[model samples]
Target: MMRRGLLAEFPTGDALIAAVRALHQEGYSRFDAFTPYPLPAVQRLLGWRRSRINYIAAFFGLSFALGAYLLQWWTAARDYPVIVGSRPAYAAPAFVPITFEMCVLGTSLSVLAALFVIIGLPRLWHPVFAIPGFERATIDRFFLGVDESDPYLDRDRTTRALLDLGALRVSLLGEEAPPP
Candidate 1:
């Protein structure tokens, strides 16, 4: 059977931490904490996997840069053979500006595309936004939740559990989870 997500909102950081620890110890493997600012300790608690997009971006950027330079050399020197008043067949200095521009352009464009895909842009809406009292996550609240997608998540039980954990407020979000 499908299950809904549970969200807990805390009034203070200490409360947030305690609730997170409680959930973590309770054998809840799929959970996430959210706050207005960085919470460095959360990573240790969650143990998120390393992201490979950086390596991908580096590989793509380097390939693009080299391809840009080589393309310029081939088109200007060998392929098309443009003669600007006998200024040598392969004038490396003359090609510098366009080559540099293309390299920068290619790297920047590819990186931007990668970022859009990585971050899931153009569809920036999130399930957390639907949680009650969650709008304050940016202002002055801390939140934690078991995603509706979590296999072991039990909607009613999780919501009740969060409320008992000293949540200032508890609620559910997303189409899968009903509003509190």
Candidate 2:
């Protein structure tokens, strides 16, 4: 079933941020904002932080490098010693290039996988597109949305909250507004 929600249009990014912050202070958390341009203040107000993909990539990269180095050492030094040019079997220097390559492979692949999982990719559509005038969200308008799944969400209440916070227009998204 399509989810219903409340949407508020704002004239400016600052206004959207302010409304989001006010709603957040009122114990509303399940909301999102759309702006024509990057708005760090809106992100901050929405409690967005640094992405965890960086940490995941770093962990995978370091682990893969260490594992590759160990495998090389074990193979060269213990499993089957190969004395080339009278050099030591466990040549740490020789493993550097392969280890670096393994690190890069691990980091790139893990980051790609994490992004797909975290961002919920592969979807062609979202219900937010049903909001009136939402198409302008990418052009000139700033929008604040309160999802229906939010525990505190109430149609009338949300409408009033957005209106009180200076929304230019408040609309019910994903569902038709009830007749007055």
Top-scoring candidate (lDDT): 2
Model 1 weakest lDDT span, ten residues long: 171-180
How many pairs of residues collide in model 2? 0
RMSD of 1: 4.5
Q: What local distance difference test score does each model get?
A: 0.74, 0.84
Tens digit of lDDT per residue, candidate 1, span 1-180? 113467778888778877778888887777777789877677567776666777766777677777877887898899998888889878888877776777677677877888788867877456666655677889899877677777667877877888888987777656644334
Candidate 1 — which pairs collide?
Answer: none
- Taking every candidate in turn, the Cα RMSD to the unseen true structure, in Å, is 4.5, 5.2
Write down the worst ten-residue block by lDDT for model 2: 171-180
Measured on C-alpha atoms, candidate 2 has an lDDT of 0.84
Candidate 2: the clashing residue pairs are none
Q: Candidate 1: where are CA atoms >4 Å away?
A: 1-3, 11-15, 80-89, 93-101, 118-121, 124-126, 138-140, 148-166, 175-180
The candidate that wins on TM-score is 1
